[model samples]
Target: MELTLAQEKALNALVYFAERIKPLYLTKAIKLLYMADEQAIRDTGVPITWLDYKAWRFGPVPEDVYNKVKQVDNLQKLDAGDGVLYSLKVSDAPADLPEGLVLNPIRPFNDDEFSDYEIEILQKVIDRYGKLTSEQLVDILHQEGTLWHRVVQANNLKQQFELKSNRSDYIIEFTDLLDTDYKKAAFEVAYQSHLMQQNLM
Candidate 1:
């Protein structure tokens, strides 16, 4: 949540401008502020995404100010290869955020929150599919009766498609589901049930 000096300056400028400008012109005002503080703005190196010269007319900011005010606005338009951009509004700023600076306000996936089964399944899917979309993998798993079964199947598919296809000696890599944690508590119940059926054996 620590903010760089440039972030602090930019945020303060935003706050100052927000107080005096008509609600419709806040976006334009921010851009102008950035222009006035060109060096500070440039230091951010975040590309402008949306240029709403008229957002303030609505009065009271939208809940998704960070997203609406992003240097890059339409996230869907960004190339997938581009690194993920983090964003946050002043209200959403973390307490630990430095004075004058706001956290970009993005959330990160917690790896520790994942269950062993989910990890195993996800890893298998990635290895096999190389880069299948999350939706595609989810659909495939849904068809397998149990979620774990779907994960196992997706994993199996990846192994068959990647390893087995490339090397005649390749064997399916089995996961010890009993020893692993699930990303969600629900996964544990499902995993244990699957194990009881000797499916994991």
Candidate 2:
């Protein structure tokens, strides 16, 4: 599938984290991206990458981004102009990635694909979560008040959560990240505008 502009940005974000974190594992990179998007939604009523996160067993997983990261073997074929240009070399791992999949960036991260606020948010995510291991990040997401935990609880699947199962996944709403009713309503407006803009392209 062709990468949407948002997906391009998300891929670049993967690259960004891979550059800063040595031996960056796939799951950890995804979690860091989710954190950045979550923080951005909290602060600005909008997500930095505009990726649609879902309540997964490990935490919030952006399925498209997850799939894209998995396609590291084929990333060199994608040539979306004006997007972050790079390729990923996947380190050897078992099929299930029990030890987590490592990603090595083969090109420089392109900051031109993002806004100033987005850059700040990414840096903040790195600063806050960059040091944590994949399992540690998952622990944070499993906390009681986190969005992932709330979704799992609301669906009565906290104890029986399954990974990559259609029956267990729930789409994470961006508005749910906002604290105030006013912010949620404003987010709806902004989201609608974003959709319209995407449709025009």
Candidate 3:
């Protein structure tokens, strides 16, 4: 399958965190992207990336991102001495934003790998979330009132929710979780979690 714009952005984001915050695990990387897009959509009426996220057991994730991480050569295994860690593989590519996709309404600058505002938001997210473990991120996503919990509770989906790939895009029509108000509320939940984590750190 042709990769979606969000998947492309995911790799770019991986590269970014690798440079700015080394030794990030795969799951945390995904959560960071999800948090950015989710928050941007609520606050600005557009997401930093046009990725559609589902309420997965671990948290909200772009299906495209979940699949790509399994096989993409762009991610490398790090020798963290004991436990595993992941980082972006080397390429001279400029980390430019892909074309032919909708983007966040309020951005940092003119051209859009991400807007300046999106970058600012990302910086805040990464600084807060990046320091935590993957397990910690999962717990944060699972919190009540967050998008994942709301989706599961609304639909009565069981844990480890099983979904066929064919049914992926189909869920969009039934779920208004993407609506602005819900998105705003969802963003607040994650943002509050970020604040709480900051204090503990």
Candidate 4:
């Protein structure tokens, strides 16, 4: 597919960053792509997605386009989770990691404010669904035009389970760490920071 000017710019930026800072987390790489796309949209008023760039703009890229981009750029993939239960190699690393695996520090969002209505919505989802996937939560919030807010809330939901599947059956259970108010707060802060940084960029 033809590359939009915005898509080209975002891909180029992603490649540039990938080369400079080999990330350990695919989500971080995806986040970088999203950030670049967000920035491109902010600058040029064009919207793009990883799927769009991979299938349309970049032209016949690999199924794992983000990972392929990292490989082509000579960046190493490291242990990371896909925010779901399964373990997957991530392409970005936190700044504090060992040498030769340096990654750009993720910027924290300045705004930590959440409206009462937002919190209420989150409580409602937790009350209704108990534990839910991020994608599922996103679908629910999309209807209300508050997908972003729910993304923040899902991140804030303290209880996390590592999903396991066997024979095409799936089970959701708690992770090793017990849920606590502190963890929930940290998740909220991180989620908000991620959202704000992406939106800002």
Candidate 5:
């Protein structure tokens, strides 16, 4: 499948993190991206990467990007058209390699694809969370009042009532990360406007 602009940004973000941490862990990369998106929404009412996240067992997972990484891991390279190449190189097979996916970028990330604000936000997220392990990040996302935790809890409640429920199948709304009703309403306006612009495009 062809990569969208946001997906390209996601890869670039991963590459940026990989450059700093050597072979970045795949789970950590995804978690960092999610955190960046959530922060972007809180700060600007827009997400840097408009990736859809699922309420997965570990945390909020950008399932599309995660699957793309797995595909690239097996194929060694993914061409996003226009001769742009995104590839992953496997590092050592540690005990947690199966779950960790220690990977390095084959090429340098293109910062030209991002705006100044986007780059700043990404770096901010890295500064805050880059050093954390995948498990630690998962713990943070699964904290009592986190959006991921809320989705998981709601799904459990639904199941307890014998209602239709799928824990990992639920989409975690990024706006839910906003703590207040005022923020949520403000985000709804911004999100609807974004949708309109996308339609015009």
Candidate 6:
């Protein structure tokens, strides 16, 4: 399948982080992107990217994004100095080679591509988690009662054999991350926006 909207947003989020958090390790980068989506899902009652997260040892990883980045690793290693993808010299990904996509200095993304809500979410997550290392972030994700925790602890057959989790499935109005107050506000905002759009239609 072609890149989904969330996938494109995931890439855009990466570009945003790379611009600010220069010399970002792919490991930290991926985790940051995941957190951005999680934070937005919590705040807005919707996810920035509807990624199918696999509960990897570090945290929840987008399996497709991981594979794609891994496939690009060889090219980054060989052509890091000159490759367009690694024009900034995506350094060695800290996580096992190929998985941590070390991003080089790349151009900042165009602002036009992101929604106002997306921009706000990305900035908020970065501001909150910017200084955190991958290990620290992993610990946060590993906390009890987290989506990562429940899915991993359960260890269903799908998880045991194929590492699948429907927990990460995307559905509006279904995020467990958001607090009740936040959910209420989000629901109100969404309802208002829906009504406005309907009026226009």
Each candidate's lDDT (Cα)? 0.32, 0.79, 0.56, 0.33, 0.75, 0.66
Candidate 3, 1-201: lDDT as tens digits: 344455555656555655555445556667888777666665664566556676666667677766665554333333323211133332222346222111121112222455688778778788788787667888988888776766667776652356533222212211244566766666567556645744664
- After TM-score superposition, the amount by which residue 166's alpha carbon in candidate 3 deviates from its true location, in angstroms, is 17
Candidate 1 stretches with Cα past 4 Å from truth are: 24-26, 38-201
lDDT of 2 by residue, 45-110 (tens): 878777888887788888877876776566646654443445566776667656757888888888
Give the true-structure RMSD of model 6. Answer: 6.8
TM-score of every model versus the real structure? 0.21, 0.85, 0.61, 0.27, 0.79, 0.67
Clashing pairs in 5: none
Q: Which candidate is the best by lDDT?
A: 2
Sorting all predicted structures by lDDT, with the top scorer first, yields 2, 5, 6, 3, 4, 1
Clashes of each: 19, 0, 4, 12, 0, 2
Please give the range of 10 consecutive residues that has the lowest summed lDDT in model 5: 76-85
- Point out the higher-scoring one by lDDT: 3 or 5: 5
**How good is model 1 by TM-score?**
0.21
The superposed Cα distance between candidate 4 and the true structure at residue 137, in angstroms, equals 19
After superposition, candidate 5 runs with Cα above 4 Å error:
73-87, 90-92, 95-99, 157-167, 178-201
lDDT for residue 79 in candidate 6, whole number 0-100 = 53
Ranking by TM-score: 2, 5, 6, 3, 4, 1
Cα lDDT tens digits, model 1, 84-133, are 23322333234653222232334332334234443343334234543433
Cα error of candidate 2 at position 184, Å: 3.3
lDDT digits (tens) for residues 1-201 of candidate 6: 234445555666777887887557777878888888777677676666666677766677887766655555565555535323443335455664444456654655656657898888888888998888878888998888878777666754235435643344322223556668867677567656645744663
Candidate 2's C-alpha runs over 4 A off are 75-85, 93-98, 162-167
